[model samples]
Target chain A: MKEGNFCCHKTTERSEKEYKSLMNRLSRIEGQIRGIKGMVERNVYCTDILIQVAAVNAALNSFNKELLAEHIRNCVVRDIREGKDETIEELVVILQKLMK
Target chain B: MKEGNFCCHKTTERSEKEYKSLMNRLSRIEGQIRGIKGMVERNVYCTDILIQVAAVNAALNSFNKELLAEHIRNCVVRDIREGKDETIEELVVILQKLMK
Candidate 1:
């Protein structure tokens, strides 16, 4: 884990390509974000802004869901395999938070 | 993101030490988590298990709050300074989810 990096697991040898693809998606999303800011600065209609806001929200939630899927497949499953049942509790706690 | 790593930002040159410290705390919490699982496997009192579960929840929440604070200070603030108001909407959406 690095200061700005919230990832707890070390990068796997095979995930570099996937990581790059995810970053590309995030970059495009980042640009769309800038477009929204421009719209706000131009005094765009509140309803229009709100619509864009909703789109962004959906996009972000999708991204988070994908990341969470990966986390469960990789981290949580590995813990279970290693007989680390306690990690299940950690995951349950995380799930509870996410559900909230 | 690298498979299991959820961090979106590149590590700064300065946060290595802080990251290590955070990981150490996480390791301790992880051990406590295993203890909870052992209690469960032993068919310990349900009330005792629930108490431990609550403690784990609080501990995890505190950890997440600290991480979120760091994220806001680093990622959100940087986006704002770079004229990215749309990032505010992203954060607002995230906060709404967290509050839920």
Candidate 2:
């Protein structure tokens, strides 16, 4: 990690492709939320809106899962190999939070 | 249900307060998402971003639960009272999706 790019608290430098993918996922999720807001505003059927909400939730979950996998593969693995055992505890804590 | 406001498929007219409350919840969720996107752009730590994503997921779940409660209390119950039994099926299907 660079000066401004700490592994955990500081930051992580993602490849351009990684950055783009994460941003794209977030952008799509954001747009979905906006669309749901529009549905609510237009007084759409409750079930219809609920179904859309489920879709957004799924998209968010997908984003979380993908990011978590990458984090484990890169950051967690590198930290462990470097004998940064605290990273394991940090990973455990976040896993608990994400599960909740 | 009014002409343009069918109970399920057509639409359901929500009270002004109901509308406002739902919109407020959605707006907050939308803002939370935007904040997450900012974190990604700033190259925040992966675990940190994952935690924020979890929070957003919880917020979305809260919104879904609230909306579902209102739908049951109003639309589902009313339809049942009116002998429109199909509403029950619709409710069941949406519940399955939400849980999924």
Candidate 3:
């Protein structure tokens, strides 16, 4: 799939490059998930399907890391620079939720 | 915004209704984030922007909850019933990460 499709589909919190990368990764993950579903439906070996599932989990984590980096650099940093310390508190809340 | 746009735009793990609901909620959240960005750019009152940001956060949480419910009901259950115990481990790992 082409990158940046989500640019029209989501908010503009990331740079075009970041946005493209994110959409690209998400697209691949989406495909990976579909593939896993096919494996399940086709009665692939349990261990093999499990391994694919693990890979999907890893892919999701990598996506999260990229998103967090973009959020910090673009949203959090900008808000702090503009004297919106409230963004810090918001970030703190999300971090708590994520770490929970 | 019309619902189910993402059904075409992404992989389909959801029923039509679920896909619609999820897509609708996400589109609204996308718009909400954009609105918050506008507030930020215009130097809206800090507290007000923060409030909207909080709303966005809540929306996101709602989305997550719905998606998680669907995952447990659909993916996890199906996998387990099919004798794929490994899906349980995958769920445990994600829950741990989310709770972290």
Instruction: Decide which is better by TM-score, 1 or 3.
Output: 3
Q: True contacts preserved, each candidate?
A: 0.00, 0.94, 0.00
Candidate 3 residue-wise lDDT, B9-98, digit = tens? 212245668766765765675566556445534444334444554565566567557766777877778879999997798778766655
The alpha-carbon deviation from the true structure for residue A63 of candidate 3, after best TM-score superposition, in angstroms, is 18
Better of 1 and 2 by TM-score: 2
Which has the better lDDT: candidate 2, or candidate 3?
A: 2
Alpha-carbon runs more than 4 Å astray in model 2: A1-9, B1-8
Give the lDDT of residue B21 in candidate 1.
49
Per-residue lDDT tens digits for candidate 1, residues A1-91, read 4212775543322166645544454455455556644553443433344455455445545544655566578766876998868767876
Question: Which parts of model 3 are misplaced by more than 4 Å?
Answer: A1-100, B1-12
Worst 10 residues of 2 chain B by lDDT: B1-10
Task: Give the clashing residue pairs of candidate 1, or none.
Answer: A6-B7, A7-B6, A7-B7, A100-B100
Per-residue lDDT of candidate 2, residues A33-63 (tens digit): 9998888877888998899899999999999
Error of 1 at B86 (Å): 3.0
Ranking by lDDT: 2, 3, 1
How close to the true structure is residue B98 of candidate 2, measured as C-alpha lDDT? Answer: 79
Better by DockQ, candidate 2 or 1: 2
What TM-scores do the predictions have?
Answer: 0.44, 0.91, 0.47
